[model samples]
Target: MLTLASKLKRDDGGKAGRASGASDSTHRVSIRDRLLTKEVSELEAHLPSTCKASFPDEDKLHHFRLAVSPDEGYYQSGRFQFEIDVPEAYNMVPPKVRCLTRIWHPNITENGEICLSLLREHSIDGTGWAPTRTLKVHHLH
Candidate 1:
């Protein structure tokens, strides 16, 4: 269990291991970027009917406006707008979500700040944000 070559390969003995580790991190970043692209593509291809997202400017991909309309509820036929700012490290980190609508609710403040526990950074489920749960947990119905 103690060969020079084996130790070097394991990253505890030399430069080659360090280089390998750096490249592995780079590879992971690449994969995350690609996965995000795929998720965006999926969002584009299959958007929910009750909600829609629109960009404020054509050049920016990180910022957008999302609109939601509930068909049958106290807010039936009411359109609520929200602004979503997707961070660079999304999926691992949650996007910033704001109400952007003037409404009174326990979860939403009049100033457009949202109080949803799932959307906040202190969530009990895995350090506050899980990209996979964002879309599913935002249902108004």
Candidate 2:
């Protein structure tokens, strides 16, 4: 004999203090966010001396910037910057990376399109992105 609204309320823990609502305390963490928490820590632990990573928004680990200054290379005097964005599909797909600083590299185009084999989703040489690949900052070069 209960109304539709009453039934919904009863089913939703009406005054029983149950966690059936989407409250802030019950915020769900996605797989991507969970993986970034671990990967970001590992990245810091093994960061190279010539490379630096900075998160503009500490809460947003999915987006970050990288600075690279080679000590002994053709671009030794130049410090290059790159933007790395980890999509929601993380391990299933490669991170979208682009060069923020203009450079004339064979692997990178002038418009910031990267040409790394591992970044490719489908590569004929069997070097395309795979789920096993981690966010290894060292492999950026």
Q: Which structure among the candidates has the greatest TM-score?
A: 2
- lDDT (Cα, tens digit) per residue for candidate 1, span 59-112: 344566778888878998999999977777766666678888888878787788
TM-score of candidate 1 to 2 decimals: 0.63
Best lDDT among the predictions, by candidate number: 2
Model 2: CA > 4 A from native: 1-26, 137-140
Kindly report which residue pairs in candidate 2 clash with one another. Answer: none
Model 1 / residue 102 / CA error / Å: 0.3
How does each model score on TM-score?
0.63, 0.79
RMSD vs true structure, all candidates: 12.5, 11.5
